[model samples]
Target: MSNADSSTKKFASQADLEAKKTSFIKLSDNAYAYTAEGDPNSGVIIGDDSVMVIDTTATPLMAKDLIRNIRSVTDKPIKYVVLSHYHAVRVLGASAYFDEGAQQVIASRGTYEMIVERGAQDMQSEIERFPRLFSGVESVPGLTWPTMVFEKEMTIFMGKLEVRLTHIGMGHTKGDTIAWIPSQKICFSGDLVEYEAAAYTGDAQLEEWPATLEALRAMQAEKLVPGRGPALLTPAQVNQGLDYTKDFVTTLLQSAKESVAAGMTLKQAMAHTRKVMDPKFGHVFIYEHCLPFDVTRAVDEAQGIKHPRIWTAARDQEMWHGLQAG
Candidate 1:
């Protein structure tokens, strides 16, 4: 396909310019979810002494609205910023929390390492791929570094409430973290689980993803705030989210493995994956946008490429043209 056709179709989310209505659903007396339709979702944990913000939006400007929503309910000082992962879309808005007097930024040690390695490239690549999501990219101060890093697990106390942040194996990314409230039976799963949305597996650990989901199930969280989609309030909805994400990962990896076994090229593998996955996940948000990247990573993993290739802006177009070409 020519650049004209590619420009129109590649990263076509710019055409999706309609604003999404944001919702702040109270999951528990101390926990709330700041979800905007299918956009990246954030979780709020209100503590007796202060508050904790999970997965700051995309930019400070965008986060100001979330802060406003938080203020609408409680004026507690925003004391903590918990990064579920190191994705730019998730952690870039951290400055807003800091400005609100956030005491410390928290993340898994692996996430901190990821931020130092390919964070810049991922930031540029993601912004270019989904301009609408980063509505105010200009407000992003810089790479968001974590103030506190934990190894395996860390239990934080927000007064009497305990917020357990654990590096729950690897699924979405190597540094995937989840915030669990044992008393409330609520968990804030980062990109490890996405509800009613396409699971972006561009940098995922596909082989280990299912096992990670099993660990989440072992929690039996009654309520969940997924990375995207609305908050899952009921046990059935939470299970649905977990099952949907697991199905997506397993199917993609299995298809890619089959393609590799048949000695199919990346382009052919993309087609094979589409035939199987599109029928089921085609209607989900960003399905078209995510498939190419997801298949590329799966193919690499199947071929024994352990680490995900860094996605630069230029590489994104090259891959899109290769996959979407007529």
Candidate 2:
């Protein structure tokens, strides 16, 4: 097959310019979800005297929309911003919250370390791949640094409400954090759990990802606000989201393992993966854009590269071109 027709299928989401309608749904009395179709999602927890935002939108301008929604209900101080992970799309919008009187930005130690290590490169890489998501990229002050960093787990009392933030194993990234409400049984599971969307496992622990999903399953969260797609309002919907994410990651890893064992090239492996992953997750949001990165990382893991390689814009282009040319 020709490279233009085969390798250059153009999964670059820059072509994805259509605007998506944003939704603000109240999952419960204290919990709400700010989602825009399949774009990045944010979680809101209105405590007795304050508001806690989980995963700020991509930029301050984008965050303004969320702020408007927050104002629609409560004008309490936006006191806390919790990062689901260190991905630029999720954390970069944190500065906007600070303008709303955000007192603290919270994240896992791993996420903090990741930011110190490769946050700049990751931020540039992400912004290049999907410019539409970063609607106000120029407004990003810089890499978001968490003021409050925790280890395995940390609990914050939003008055009587108990918001538990935990480093729930490694699926999406080293510092995958989830904000859980014990009283309401609601969870804000960053990219670790995406409903009807592709999980970007480029910075993932492929071998251990499934187990992490299992750990999240043990939470038994009745309502879940995933990183993308609609909120999983019911326990059954939560299960489906977990299942979808687990299936997506496992399929990529298993396929990469097969391709590597057969000594197939990266481009060849992507094709091999499509046979299985496409049939199941082909129609999901960002599937085409994420597949190559996911497959490449899976291949590295299969070859015993435990830590995921940093993805820079140049490297991304090289990989994309190589995959397409082959």
Error of 2 at 50 (Å): 0.7
Cα lDDT tens digits, model 2, 1-326, are 23345535444576788889999999988999999899999999999989999999999989999999999999899999999899999988889898899999999999999999999999999998988999979999999999999999999998888899999898899999999999889999999999888889999998888899899999899999998999998999999999998888888999999999999999899999999999998898888788889889999999999989999999888888878784
Tens digit per residue, CA lDDT, model 1, 1-326 = 33236545556564567788999999888999999888899999998999999999999999999999999999899999999998889999999998788989999988998888999999998888888889788999899999999998999899999989999899999999999999989999989999888999998989999999999999999999999998999999999999999999999999999999999988899889989998999899878778889999999999999878888989988887787665
Ten-residue region with minimum lDDT total, candidate 2: 1-10
Residue pairs clashing, model 1: none
- Kindly provide the TM-score of model 2 when superposed on the true structure, using C-alpha atoms: 0.97
Where model 2 places Cα greater than 4 Å from the true spot, the runs are 1-11
All models: lDDT? 0.91, 0.91
RMSD of each: 1.8, 1.8
* Model 1: lDDT of residue 141: 89
Model 1, residue 93: distance off in Å is 0.6
